[model samples]
Target: MDSYKLLINLPDTIVFLSPNLKVVDATDEYLKATMKTREELIGQDFLTTFPDNPSELLSHNMMIVRDSLMRVIATKDTDLLATLRYDIPKPESQGGGFEERYWEAVHKPVVDENGNLKYIIQRTSDVTQNVLAKRAAELEENKYRFMMNALPQLIYTTDNTGRATFFNQKWYDYTGTNPDILATNSWQSSIHPEDLPKVIEKVGHSLRNGTEFQMELRVRNGKGIYRWFLTRSIPMRDENNNILMWVGSSVDVHNTREMVFELEQSHEQMVELSEQVQQAYGKAEAERKVLHNLIMKAPVFFCVLRGPEHRYELMNERYQKLFPNRNLIGQSVAEALPEVAEQGFVKVLDEVYETGREFVAEKIKVTLDRYGNGKLEEMTLTFMYQTIYDENSKVTGIMVCGFDVGEQISS
Candidate 1:
């Protein structure tokens, strides 16, 4: 029986080496792939026959391959190389320099009947395409992760069973919570104690029904302060319509909630002030009607300030429109219009209150953050700060009436 002929007929590129790691025989496929002849490779050391290419970067060094083969010889066990880059020298007829190549090499020991290692069979498979494709895929995945982490919202993903699987870097930064803590659907730990129950119940229902999930709830931030967040999630399903994963995000809505609350409070204060004004018009209906019609329909801003801090007591429709959605009632002048403090308005109010005299300012240029976008705008206003007096001639409060004269000034 010709065992050598049978060994050479196997499919993969194969080479037989002596126990001393010297090439003894090689198949036709091995000679063709390596661009080497039987006469040139025979009796040559395995490492010397395929040496490391010094010019190529990150190429596999033969020393590592040699050590692996030695380990197999010592232990009489097979050694496998998962994947490695090795540049192969081209024949002189072709370019004589090395060509880039990747391979999966396997070395198996050939033991004799007496349990002595006599030869080693080396097999190799070309895996260059697979390795390069995997590297490109990794690069693309890294870019996607970077974009997700750059978002201001807290983004996360969960498996079909509602177990938290992945979270973006913003989640860790905003919550200061380790992902390990929420690995097993324990993400509720970051929610406010009062809101956690509702959040869990609603999320559980969504996972069970595979429906859209949304909630406005308070969550504790890294600073240990609770803030409102609008959380929304959607299911990712396979072609068969089976849920595979859930993608979710939480946006901070603290400022929006504050604005809504302030608007509601302002509405209630305006209704109460209207009732008070109506009750004060018990007698002299003609005079009261004239004052009421002028205050309501006067195209100018009108508001009354009371108390030592000059808290907003009453404001007309035009006055409320000037600072829309700002809960001006029950707020002092410095607290409500903080941007006006340095513009001499507060000083004028103080002088009027102390001397019980009226202070009139014309074409006063004031800087205000009109839209709350962190930008200040200059506005010209003609206003009067007049002191109110009770029947006993005691200063009670200040009445401010103003009109935006920016257009007039420009014209």
Candidate 2:
């Protein structure tokens, strides 16, 4: 009896029989379910066990047990047999079907007759939980559809070939056409003819390559006005990376187009301001040249020396009188004058180049042959030579231009 392990204390109902189809034993489960007792079932015949067929479940479900056991023995199959079925009782008052509690029954062969099967066993488990879960999932899908329908933006979809699959109610409400009308094309019957080709081309590319789609096109609104819309789409792909469909949306962009036109108007104003700035620059250039000429002729012994190259770029009238007809431009220290080399000017050049030092000789003792060539240890001159730099901040050259305006001190 324990080998009838499943029958020991089943929560629902169970019955065990012998090879002669006699009720050799019965479970407390079966007795309680049928409103009978163990003694009433012990020696009863199988046909008389459930005398009323207990709602005819015997003849209806006995074939399921016999067929499943035969199918297993015949082919040695292991897949779940489709013989399992549901049974739920209902009165006419309950509308001819059970409210919700679904049941699943299982049957198996328990005994074999002289080299063939004799006794078969059965068990049923409640399936209300599974049925309820499926019902809830369906309700959730409908709820999602309702939310999508409430959106103000026009929603649409297409298959992998860019053929329309879905267009929401809002789209139909705006276009004044049935939702089914656009199955063959997305913007065909709806878009302005001038924008149709480009919209179709972009949508086709996105569908074929599973890419995101975006384009501007004109759509006819409910009022029959052709307005611009920015349509965008994203590809929906399956688990295997194959394109399943394309999901998309469109928004009215007429207001944004007007804003863009205003921005262009502002751009034209900026162009006119740029022309005025250019005219101001030309006037500034003319004044700058006049000032430069004045700086070259002022009564001062000053010149713009070209760094340590010792070349004179711009010299004043005083400096010009001091060195007459001397073209010192493009001349290095050694090539400028023999006197420039005779002095320690070359040493200063090499020192500044190696050490990046600023040399400013505000006062120095020197012999100038403008009066006469006489070497003096301290013929005082007010000279100033300092470093000058270009835009790159490099110490490119030294400015060595100043006047000698001093007399020697009496020793």
Candidate 3:
């Protein structure tokens, strides 16, 4: 077989350039790949035949290719160019436009026996598909990261072995920690010391059994205050049901927890007061004074509705603060808070009074003109309405107690 014919029929896209960078020859594969004939490329200046795409403003294709060829000649050694965007122009029959293309090229110097450069052999492979796929994957990853950072809950991911791999922006903001913590077991340092042991044990159990991990723990904030968080995590599994990773979120529940605790304590106090009032009917005036003092000193809101009309006979400072500068005492529930009445709170109070039973609601949403500004604001509360009784065991009034839990619910 003829050596030149063998080179022309080679499968690899190969081209030969003269010492002056003129295209001397190209394989049949190179001609087909460039959508050109041998007559159009042979003896043509290499740069002139393959110019940079005119539409690409910052195109450095010509400069990059020229530099590599020059380096091969100067060093009398092969030069490699990885992942270069060298678009090819379509033939007139193909509508005459540039087709975006990527390539990896190798320029090997054909040196004389005396070590002088004679010609350069260039080989290239199309890598457009690989480059485009990589870019698409990167864009999807960036979108996922943005969504994670935008969430109100602190989100994180970890390997199946329980090592921390990723954390959203809220986590860093709340804990005041960096990615360096992932290298060590110090990520748990942000957890309250009292809660850390339990967290570790629960996480270890999940890792061993591939079960969901969940717990309510206190986490220290950037300001050094510890707050309660309800955290839950589940394993991401593959087709074979093997755990690949763990995704988790921690929702702040500090406000709701505190409010509930205080509400329980106040409920106990109210129960004691009811017993005292019923037992010491002769000392009613003295017991009323003590009840007034207790209501005033209470941390949560408190109010008393007297008679079947549900008139606000007494209200604590906290209850009054709900509608600042507005008089609630001596007015019926419907009159003082028309919005609350519209939401059927009065009907709830009536049921408690008639049935002689306590009504409890948790994280109930209510719309109120809280500042008396006529602009309605939504709030969440955990509250109770307890029926008050007379010495005759007949229900005469109702006691209202609640705590605003809007912040916790919204979070």
Candidate 4:
């Protein structure tokens, strides 16, 4: 580890000067580079290697080399690395030539036991590729930030604990909150109270299951209006499926909810109004039919009774027409009509006399031998029965009406 031996035999020896500024040992590599042998250069001075002219490299005044070597010696105990640029005289093949060599050297001060300064150690490294790569990464980071801030949808990221760590500018603009609010309960405050429980349930389930998350809920805007937000979150995980982080997006659905509510309101109003109008028309039609039957007939086709024992009562032309050849005054209908018992008409009349509800039979048809030779004829009779009521709304007797409808039935 002798300095003289290392300096003379080192293959990359550009030059190695002693502390006394003397050429005590010219490196073998230096001698070999100069097209000279060691025997002729071992004890020679620095002036013997090059021309001893005043302006040449070995001259009386080498200002650049002297100043550089002086600075390296003085700064040996201070800065660890040093840089120096120098012009190396190239081979004078056809003309005088020069080249610039930039050297970045690491310098360390060597010391002796007597606390005397010794020769310094230096090492050089090239950094052409490293500097270029570092610059490229800086440019990429700026580009990414620009794109994120310009996004319309809110972009957000959270840790595995469901705590927010990062969100884009769009999220802040929509929510009117800063990054300081992210670690707090600011995000939960934005969600509507009604939708909070479902979002929590699903998010908790996905977190425990180590799966992606998705949810839809109403979120309060800056103006304090609740709007629908469709959130989709994807779990970021390690290779073993352990949760690392989550990424999600929020999209606005305010217009969609408003439109749906409007349609539902319109449908409900239509249903209620239709039912009201239908009931009103049905009642009016029923009343018109009752009034028309009373006033439209001259010699009425109906009659009523009023006193005890169902005595002989008033009759109509239609009734007298049925028994045309007989004087039908003061004659009971049950006695005159022999088929009344078989037709069940008296039973219905008795029920009406007790209940006082108007009871009517639509129609009944009988085939009678009308001709003398026993030829058959068909007749249809419609009877309406009602229990007559007095001034006190008490039942007095029954009213019955009959109509022949055999021809109307065929039509």
Candidate 5:
């Protein structure tokens, strides 16, 4: 067999260059891949024949290729270049533009008996698809991280063995701890002593059984004040339903729990004093007023929506301030806040109302025409919809309570 014919017919995209970096020859596969014929490539300078894409202002393809070739010459050994974006120009008949491409290349030097470099052999493979796929995956991961960090709740991830692996910024901010704490039991030390045992037992059981873990525990904040947090963790599974990891969130519910306790106490006192109609009625009314005042003065926004259409029955001062120009009371949510409905809040409301289940969402994005000028503005909220019941235990309305966390997240 002819040696030159054998080299040209080889199935790999290979090119041979002289010691002076002049193209000596290339395989047929190389000619086809580069959209050039042997007549156009042979005898031409290797760098001149395949120049960097001029349209790309920050292109470093020529520099990288030259450095790899120089390294091979210096070491007299093979040099590998991975994931290089070396675009190729199209022929004028093909509309005359550069086509974006990625490649993996190997540059090997052939030496003579005297150890002098004779020829440089280049082998390259197109890796455009793999490079693009990796970039897309990285972009998706970045988006996921952005969403996690935007949440008001503390977000974390753990291995199947219940060992913590990752925690978002909110976790560090709330705990006033650094990444070093994850390696030790320092995070657990922040949990109240009374709640630590239960948390450990529940987490261990969940890890053993691959079940969801949930608990309301008191966690000490940056100021060393213990506050109640509703913590929940769910197992992330693989295709075969095997546990891979755990994703968890801890939402601070201290104020809501305190308010509920106060309401329950007031309800019990009203029931006990019911026999004395005049005295009971006055005392119950006074208690109701005090509770109303407390709700009004709370830091979070609060509202009550009645009926299936979600007509705004009442809104606290904070809630009303969210849409100062709109008349929310006596108006359906869809009528008063069309933008909210457009963003699918009404569907979420319907689901909660129909199921009679509380829906809690943290860092939910809500767009509103705040000034009634038809200009939409986006805001982030950490909120909940709790089912309200009538005297006979029939679901009547929904109580909406939330904090506008836009400023907090931005800062």
Candidate 6:
């Protein structure tokens, strides 16, 4: 029987180790994974051939591996190491430095029928990508937590079971309660007694139906005064459209509610005054006022560019941050962002104009002068350019809407 032939055909990266921890044989996958040839590895001591990289955080990674191998040999039991950060050194021709890596490894002992240790089978899987992705997610979650805490409004998150998972610092500040108490659902104790049952019933119905949960209820503040708040929750879903958790916010609306009630009570007196004001100003002015307010206050970055040259016609407050000092209202993209023309974004605009087609781009990479310095830096943005048509149904301009999603792209 050809023992080596069987080991060589395995798809996983595997290495056969003698009792003394020498590399007796390895699979082709092992050779390709390690960028090594059979002659360089076959007779070498396993630890010496793949030593712990000096750049690694833990100096004893190799030592820990050796200990695991020894334990398997002594007990004749398989040992699994879930994950370890172990960098690998590149060959001299490849610049000779260690590259960061992660591995899921196992040491399986091969015992003879007489219960004597014959060899150790070491198998390893590269899991660097998974580790990095998990780390990035953690960092992003932490960033969001910080942002939530900074806001004045109370914010909270709950798991699928409707149990509290997280509450921002603002929640504690407003409720005068700590996480330990909130963890036990004590935050609900701050709700107005008369409104509690109604709020809970509404929330229960939303949770059961997987719909948006919203309620206007009076909440007791830190000073023990009940004030009106509009608490709302939305489901956060995964890529598969399955609800993962609930993110909710509690916004104080006590003053606004009081003002609205006062206005309603004085409607008879305001009716005459409102009619006089309407007579003074045409109906078109009122409509324009409403439209202007919507554009100025909308959360998204909104803009419009007219003509084939793509001269900017309008930009909202949020869009103005793209280039703080430079006014883009009448400048073409090429004139306002000369650095972008070289990055091929100007060509993208031209294509959209020529075809009169809406262009949607996500994570589009461009080099721009982020700090007003002549030196350009790369940035990623997700944006859309929709053609605006004239009365004759001809393309006249492009409407733009987008925001900076660089953090998401990098993650």
Model 1 CA deviation exceeding 4 Å by range: 1-5, 28-45, 71-82, 90-102, 111-118, 125-130, 271-411
The Cα local distance difference test for each model comes to 0.81, 0.60, 0.85, 0.59, 0.86, 0.80
Query: Largest TM-score belongs to which candidate?
Result: 5
* Model 4 lDDT-worst window of ten: 291-300
**Candidate 4 positional error at 34, Å:** 21
Query: Compared with the true structure, what per-residue lDDT tens digits does model 6 show for residues 207-293?
Result: 888988877899887899899987878888899988899988877767546744654445534444556565678655654554555
Q: Candidates' TM-scores? A: 0.60, 0.40, 0.67, 0.42, 0.72, 0.58
The lDDT leader among the candidates is 5
Candidate 1 lDDT by residue in tens digits, 58-96? 785787788889998999999998788888888899969
lDDT (tens digit, per residue) of candidate 4 on 41-90: 44454333443233335323334444445676776563333433333344
Off by over 4 Å in 2: 1-99, 102-134, 182-187, 269-411
* Ranking of candidates on TM-score, top first: 5, 3, 1, 6, 4, 2
Estimate the lDDT of model 2: 0.60
After superposing candidate 5 on the true structure, give the runs of residues whose Cα lies further than 4 Å from its correct spot.
71-77, 80-83, 274-383, 387-398, 401-411
The regions of model 6 sitting more than 4 angstroms off are 1-3, 72-78, 111-116, 159-164, 180-183, 204-215, 235-245, 255-411
Model 6 lDDT at residue 178: 85
In model 4, the clashing pairs are none
On lDDT, who's better, 3 or 6? 3
Query: lDDT tens string, model 5, 143-208?
Result: 998999997779999988888888898988988888887788468978999999999999999998
Q: Model 4 lDDT vs. the true structure?
A: 0.59
Clashes of each: 0, 3, 0, 0, 0, 0
For residues 138-194, write the lDDT of model 3, one tens digit per residue: 999999999999877789999988989999999999999887887875888899998
